[model samples]
Target: MSALRSRKIKYFFILPSIIWVLAFTIFPLFYSLGLSFFKVRLGKPTHFVGLANFERIINDYKLVNSLKVTLLYVAITVTVQIVLGILLALLFHQETKGKSILRALMILPIFCTPVAVGYLGLTIFYEEGGPLNSFLMSLFGAKIPWLSHPTWAWVAVLLLDIWQWTPFCFLVILAGLQSLSEEIYDAAYIDSSSEWEIFRKIALPMIQPVVIIVLLLRLIESFKIFDVIFSLTGGGPGTATEVFSLYTYRTGLRFFDFGYASALSYLLLAIVMIIINLFFKRIRAVYE
Candidate 1:
């Protein structure tokens, strides 16, 4: 009876969180799933459309372009963040003076809002009046079209992502680095293992799981990237930077095509799920 009472108390404590998840996350997700299947329009009854929305998505060129851009963005941003984060983590892990201060300073960017970062990027990269163009013209006497050019715009977006999220990746990797046993490194040092050898043979393997998780998180976040691009470029220069989220936003809110936008969102969700599944499968394979 005591055990039962304890379990019931535990359940009662957890009930709020479970209810919150159901109300916010699970319920909304199912609602979106239903939305994906229906022909939804503003101020009109939502009619069941079977797989019509899905079929429409298959034929939509804009959705296809958005998917491609989103996938590319995720691939590039996630790779860069992980690699740079690991490098920074390794550098900071060494014995140095003011290491704590450096770590605290590095974590500042992670705490910054994405919208603020986007605005900062704009301040730096905006044409005619931005710092970047001003510097270039003063130093080398050359004018660069950062916001005007498609390639430069994309590079700016990547730069913003790297600046904002690298800190997060650094924190995760640094935590992992800290958790690694010092005895292992001491033994490696006694064995006359080079720093490269130590990193490859000792550190890499120990941190692989954290790396995988960080990569997955970055990948997912990048796919949903909107605010940065929207604030920076508004997916302008002729759909050059229009990623999936931005595309769907334009479709639904700007164009008011709820059904098509819903279809695009569903397709985006499917792609995200597929990528997540692939990552898990790779992780499982490595573990096995």
Candidate 2:
């Protein structure tokens, strides 16, 4: 009886967390899943539509374009973040005076709110008299449109994402670097291995798991990028920066197409899941 009571008490302790997940996570997920199969619009009675919503999404031109843009954004941002982050991690990993201060400063951008970052990006990329253009004009007597031109607007969004997220990659890689076995490095040095060889042959292989984990996390987050694009460009300059999340938000909130929006969201979820599965498979292959 006492053992049963103790088990009950332990369950009581976890009840709140279970309830929270049920109410916020699991319930909403199921609700959205059901909603995706219905034709739900504001001021109209919802009707069962089976796979109609999914079919509509598959045929959606805006969704297709948003997918392309999102893929481009994710590819560019994640690649750049990984490369630059690894370089920065290596540079800052050395013990030097002021290294702590520099590391703290590096994380400031990541610590800022995404909405705040987006608004700050808006100011920086403002067309006529923004600081970037102003500096360029003063220096070269040329002002390139940063926010108004479609290509430049895409670049601005990309730049904002890179600035905000590169620090995350850097911090993760730095942690991996710091956790490395010092004795291994000592032995490598005793063997007269060059720094490049030490990193490429030893350090990188040891940190491969951390790097893969960071890439997966960033890829998932980058796919759901909405606040930054919403506030920075508003998917403007002719839908050039309309990512999947932003497109879904515009459809559901702005256009009141709940069913279709739900479908698009599920598609995004599926894409992320597929990418994560691939990463896991790669990790298994590497380890096995």
Candidate 3:
């Protein structure tokens, strides 16, 4: 009875969060799942369509294009973030003059919103009026169509994502570096290890967990990227930068193809789950 009473007391504190999750997250997820089976249209009767929606998605050219674009964006952004973040973290890990101020400046991008970052990208990359073009005009006297061409539009979006998120990876990696014991470094020095040998043999091994975590976070965040691309490219002069999220938004809200959009969302969820599982397996193997 005493144990039961203690359990009840703990349950009382947990009830609010459970209720909140049920009301907001669980409910919406189930509702969307339900909607995926019906042919729902505005001001029209929803008919059960079974797997018709899923079948349509299999043949959707635009959806395929969006998927390709989304994967490319995710791959490029995550790779750049991990590489730059680790380099920055390693650079700032040592004690030096003005290091504190440099660390603060390095983290500034993490505090900025995605929308603000996108707008800032516009200011820097805008074809005729931006600083990049202005500088180019001063030198070689030409402008780059950064946001107009389909290829360049994707590149521009990737740049915005990298600028805003590299700092996030840097912060996480830096924390991981701080958590490591200094004894290892001292021992390596006593053994007359070169700097490169110490980094490869000791530093990399110690920070592997942090690198995995940083890569996973960046992968998930990049896969669902919408705000920066939306604000900067609006999916571009064409469907060039139309990512999976924007594709879902257009289908659900703009086109009122609720069933199809829900199906697409679930498909994306499945893909992400698979990717995460594979990543975990790969990282676990490395640890072993």
Candidate 4:
């Protein structure tokens, strides 16, 4: 009786969380999935359209372009973040003056809200009198359009993502570095191994799990990037900066195309799942 009662009590404690997930997560997901199979627009009777929504998504030019832009953004941001993060981790791992203060300062950008960061990017990258162009103008008497041109707008968004999220990668890698066995490094030194050889052969391998984790997290988050691009560029000058999430938002909210938006979102979800699965499979194969 006591054991049964204890189990019931435990479930009672977890019931709220289960309800929350069902109400906010699972229910909405299933509802969206159902909605994707219909033709739903605001103030209109929804009618079952079978696979029409998905079919339309497959033929969507904006979706295709958004996919390309999203892939490019993810590729550039994740690659740069991982590389720079590891390098920063290694640099900060050394016993140096102001290391603590610098580490504290590094976390500030990560703590700031993404929307705020997007707005900050606007100020920093503004065309006429922004700080970046102002500096360039004074130095070289030239002012490049950071937001007006497609390429520079893309670059501006990329820089904002890198600045905001690199610290997350840095902190993860730094923790990995700190958790490493100093004894192994001491032995390597005793064997007359150079610092480069030690890091290349030992540290890198030891931190593989951390790197993978950081990569997965950054990839997922960057795939869903919207607010930064929305607030910064508003997918402006063209569809050049329209990421997948932003495109979906514009479709559903701005255009009131719920069914199509739902289909697009599911497509994105499937793509993310496939990529994640492939990444894990590759990692497993390599480790095996």
Give the top-scoring candidate (TM-score).
4
lDDT of each: 0.86, 0.89, 0.87, 0.90
Q: For each candidate, what TM-score against the reference?
A: 0.89, 0.91, 0.91, 0.92
Query: How does residue 31 of candidate 4 score in lDDT?
Result: 89
Winner by lDDT:
4
lDDT of 4 by residue, 72-130 (tens): 99999999999999999999998889988998999998888888889989999988899
Ranking by TM-score: 4, 3, 2, 1
Superposed model 3: Cα runs more than 4 Å off:
1-6, 43-45, 279-288
Report the Cα lDDT for residue 224, model 3: 84
lDDT of 1: 0.86
Question: Model 4: runs farther than 4 Å from truth?
Answer: 1-6, 43-45, 279-288
Better of 2 and 4 by TM-score: 4
In model 3, state the lDDT of residue 245. Answer: 97
Q: What is the lDDT of residue 228 in candidate 4?
A: 91
Please give, for residues 175-202, the per-residue lDDT of candidate 2 as tens digits. 9999998998999999998999999999
Q: Write the per-residue lDDT of candidate 3 for residues 1-288, one digit (tens) a residue.
A: 134455667878999999999999989989889889899888242799998999998899999999999998888889988899888888888987898788789789888888878888888998987898899899998878999989987888888888888988998999998898999889999998898899889988999988988888778878888888888999886999999999999999898889888999999999998988978877677666
